[model samples]
Target: MTHRIAAFGAALLATTALTVTSLSAETLRWARAAEALTQDPHAQNEGPTTTLNHQIYEPLILRNMAGEMEPALATSWEPSADNPNVWVFQIREGVTFHGGETFDASDVVFSLNRAMSENSNFRELLSGVTEVRATGDYVVEIETEGPNPLLPNNLTNIFMMDEGWSVENGAEEVQDYAGGEDTFSARNSNGTGPYVLTSREADVETVLTLNENYWGIGEFPLDVTEIIFTPIQNPATRLAAFLTGEVDFIQDVPVQDLAQVEAADGIGLGTGPQNRNIFFGLNVGADNLERDNVDGANPFADVRVREAMMIAINREAIQQVVMRGQSDPTGAMLPPPVNGWTEELEQYPEFDLDRARALMEEAGYGDGFSIQLDCPNDRYVNDEAICQAAVGMFAQIGITVNLSALPRAQHFPLIANGETDFYMLGWGVPTYDSEYVFNFLYHTRNDGRGSWNGTNFSNAEMDEMIVSLSSETDLEARNATIAELWEMAEAEMIYLPIHHQVLNWGVSDAWSTLVDADDQVKFKYFELN
Candidate 1:
């Protein structure tokens, strides 16, 4: 098992690693398992989407590959001396968007408000903010509902866009990604980051060239002048691209090909435990599932069925065979890097066929039932395989699973639209906090939170507990609340956690970089030999 506890812990209470890149390569071709959902920065809060955005967009603050807090568009930020609720950020001077628009505090104000809008996927992260205003030419003030100590942490991936450019292009509104609305911003972008978008073909290829006028010209290596990114969903095809030098770097090297990649000359395999976990979401709150054949009653609504399903599939076996020993089997959603993770919380119950069948019988499901398990074939490592394995395991408990695997682009919508009874999802914590997980995954679907909560689980009291995390200033007390919330989420068994994902990046010897714990690659930090 990938060292289940090898992450940075509170040290990540914590962010990125910066290594010097020499001037050598002018172009770098990158390949990953999936592509960004959209070019609109706030459209999708998915990991691949954010990672690609980091190359073109600039956030007020960002986590480097090492996972450390670093300055980006904002030079410095601190809570106002007169008001604990207000956070003041000093915008970077002389910085301009790709379209040459000057960056200022007004742009910051506009971008934040846009991110907090109804269609934005990032609204949950900024739900505590009550107001955002330009206090000066280069000073922006953000007032939260209360003292939000971890405000900066949430800003790590909240990228900023040019206010003037966005309005002119009729992209003032965020993309309604889950609703399948595609606007101008979803195909084009203008950011103040190290690179500028040359062309984007969505799932086909995206070309980016370095911004010669970027503010960080002297501060960063700026060696890689151009970037050619391709998303090859097939594992074998992606690996072959890397081996043939058709691609310079591969973000996800399949576990089955690790030995081949390691043995290949001029290739280096970078590995680390990512701050993400893979889980199966069950629609337990629904009175009757939309795809199950259990009459008017939902089998998942019963706790015994949920628990039985949870303990039936052997995680250790999946870790060894499905993942090929590149995963850490776990029961908790929060990875080791997050603020609320504890060893005790990761203790998953052992798989027992007899117990699972008995529980199924107790839940009046001993005769078994059929359910459709929606899964993504290109999203995570061995994602479809894991679902396929579960299908067999479920059969032992008299539950028949009908597997429906699709590309990430098609599979995610089913969850968002509440069209699937069961699904597979992976979450990465950019904030390195538990509040982010609870707000999006545990809270009841409402104004800003629970946008991804497809399970239909809702609890007013638990929702209150989840909401209290942003304003609770006392660290010890806030963590206590997190523990309580975790207990509640676990007791409900809304999701069955499989494991924390392990990151594997294959790099050419010509360039060097670390396996970013967040799985985000910043080309500016790539070191050339």
Candidate 2:
């Protein structure tokens, strides 16, 4: 069931092959289900996209594979003594971009400003920021609307771009990803990271070389001299590459095929719980949905209908059948590792087919309505199968769901641009805080926030509460507000929680890595055994 042929290969041919003489132990051949959406660091806030970008582009701060904060482009950050509203960052020195440009404070200020632009998907994480200025060379000051303590946490994925290279290539503005606008930055990259992008062929393969001038040369193991990344969307084909030793490290070892991977020799399977959750979003704010067969109104707009849909979905069944006991079924939007997740929020609603049917009848959807469910085939573990299971569950409540599964590239835009009535999404809290969750999922879809809020649920009162979490310095009060917000979101049933994902990576015994809770693979941290 595991070793099959990939349509694209050399390092991925059907039979056993060696890319650099036994993976070279220096060249790490890696494969995953999805590819980075674009090369523009600030374009997409997705897990796969950010994970790839982390290899080539250096962020001000970084969450290492072990989920600990480590200084990257910036060595240290602290609030300004002169003003609590202003935070000061000491940028790393003697760093050079792949294009041979020197790194400095101006790049941080420029990159931060660019990330706040309208087209930037990361703008929500930088909310409440009023100004960014270069106080001095290697020193930058960020002034917020008020005293902010979690600013450093949000900067982990906010990558720094060379100001001169960006401006010269007309990439000063973030790519309009939802608008389908392509720019030079989307295809090319110049970063101050450990690896340099040598070549790229989207969805096919990409090559990166070791950066001899990397600032962390001596600080890290730096044993991996080169990287070969390929996007093998087909799980069987991907596993085949790994089983045959064509690929050394595969991040997603399919749940159904985990046993087979363990049975193989010279390969190790690493496992852990990831800080992410899968959920379904509904277009509740729209008066009418284009994809649903409902007259003059949105069936999902009714809270009873949402509740009916929620209770009808059996998380236990999904966890056992679809995920193969590789998931933690959840009721809350935020994962357990997050700051605000509680036992009360973790309890999912009881599954009752009769009650679900009654609620549907009470909500005037007794006859039910047909709607298309948008899902990505390659994004999560058995993402399409999970939707398929839900189809049968929804059918029990008199709802007809037509599933449309597409590749991640085409699927994510549908949700971002408000083009889907119902869709599947997975969220990972890099900051491990509820503010990061609410800012993108609960806030109104405007003012550079809620880019991921495909639900169309808008409330001024809720938006104010979401924004307050950014600048509220009091930890006790901020957490209380987060709890209240979670209560409100859960009550509204804006999203149907599925389960938290588990991490399963298969690697060659020549190298080893810690299982990152975020499921991010930083090859720079790899240790040669």
Candidate 3:
């Protein structure tokens, strides 16, 4: 009764032959159970969108699932001895873009500068980045405000663009691809990674081919001439497609389908620890709100009220029932394995309705208060169900939660704009560090730039600690700073961290080099054996 596929190739041939026969040469077809709003890497937050861009665009530095930094576009980097605020990087050589443009200092400079520019959603992502300069054709130097230690981690998301292609196409604007058609970088790729983008059908499917020009790694040892990605919205439909051999891999296997996937033969289920932490963020800055008949007031402005809501919700029940034993309930905002920064903090606390009631009564909410909650139906495992469970739990303690579950495309902008009083979100650590989660989600102010502090969770002490951790090069001192940040977040309940769900990447057994790193599945690293 094992769910392992036997003679998987023959099975795939039987199911995919119908449509794959018509697929162009060197094409690999994959599937997503949802849709993406744009092809731009900097603008989107969902997992599926990130996987697509990772194939075509190479970030300056790459990160592993354990949050360690590795070489990618940048070969090596070190801080300037004389200038604690400045860091220097040696760009990898002999690399060319898909359009035959060389990778060098100029591209690094342009990309970093663009990321920090105004109106670009990545601006906060480049915080404290004062200047980017090319000391040599293959060497780039970055100056920051302080002794920033997380620069390498931050470098993992500043994707390098072809200077020549961008300049010629007149797309130097910071947000040129925010919501536009596929550009040269989208449909084609000239990265130093293992794959190249060959074709893209917007939200439907995208095809990629192994990069023959990849300089770091020798030609990938598989014969996957092409990789095609497809987005299907229904869980049953996606599972049906996989069971029928119509697709080789599927992302985010639904909770209900886990047993079926494991029990079926000729199929395999891949699971690992993901960096994402699902939580609810409150708009503490919102001016218009009803809190215990107090007109135009925000209860979330008080730490006590925020903490009360955390105690009222039952994280354990969600983990056991709704999550179906697929999650880890947490007290800290950042998950474990994010370096030594995850401290031993107080638990999120058992769900004590009476204690919650007492706290609310003290905060002038004995009768509870009404607030709007924004949620995305297709973003996380049991996202809507989790929110609904929270709504029911809160109702038991007198909190009225109005739930609205919409698609991610529409939900992202609204939450980023602070249009929702509260919302459900799962953040994957792009840098694999606690600083990435703490600074981006809790410390930084939500200005709709690049930072994810959409809930306006701000504290001067936390902000100072984040800045210090960013510039501190000493590992011990940096860890100490990270601990301070986490402690503050726990004390303040900045974000109610649910369990770090196990990432399930169900794919064909023939796909090699398919390890789960950074909780992302890049088709470039995978090949049909």
What is the C-alpha local distance difference test score of each model?
A: 0.88, 0.88, 0.68
Minimal lDDT window, size 10, model 1: 14-23
lDDT: the better of candidates 1 and 3: 1
After superposition, candidate 3 runs with Cα above 4 Å error: 1-27, 64-68, 81-84, 176-192, 216-219, 290-294, 340-343, 444-450, 513-517, 527-529
lDDT of 2 at 414: 97
RMSD of 1: 2.3
Model 1 lDDT per residue over 148-244, tens place = 8889898988989999999999999998887889899998999999999999888899999999999999898877889999999989999999888
RMSD per model, one decimal: 2.3, 6.0, 6.1
Deviation (Å) of 247 in candidate 1 = 0.9
In model 1, what are the clashing residue pairs, if there are any? 15-67, 15-68, 16-64, 16-66, 16-67, 16-68, 17-65, 17-66, 21-527
Off by over 4 Å in 1: 1-24
| Per-residue lDDT of candidate 3, residues 95-182 (tens digit) | 8887778888999898777666654556666777878899999998899877787777677766788777777875565543434444
Q: For residues 412-491, what per-residue lDDT tens digits would candidate 2 score against the true structure? A: 99999899999999999989899998999888999779999999999888899989998999999999998999988888
How far residue 519's Cα lies from its native spot in candidate 1, in Å, is: 0.6
Of the pair 2 and 3, which is ahead by TM-score?
2
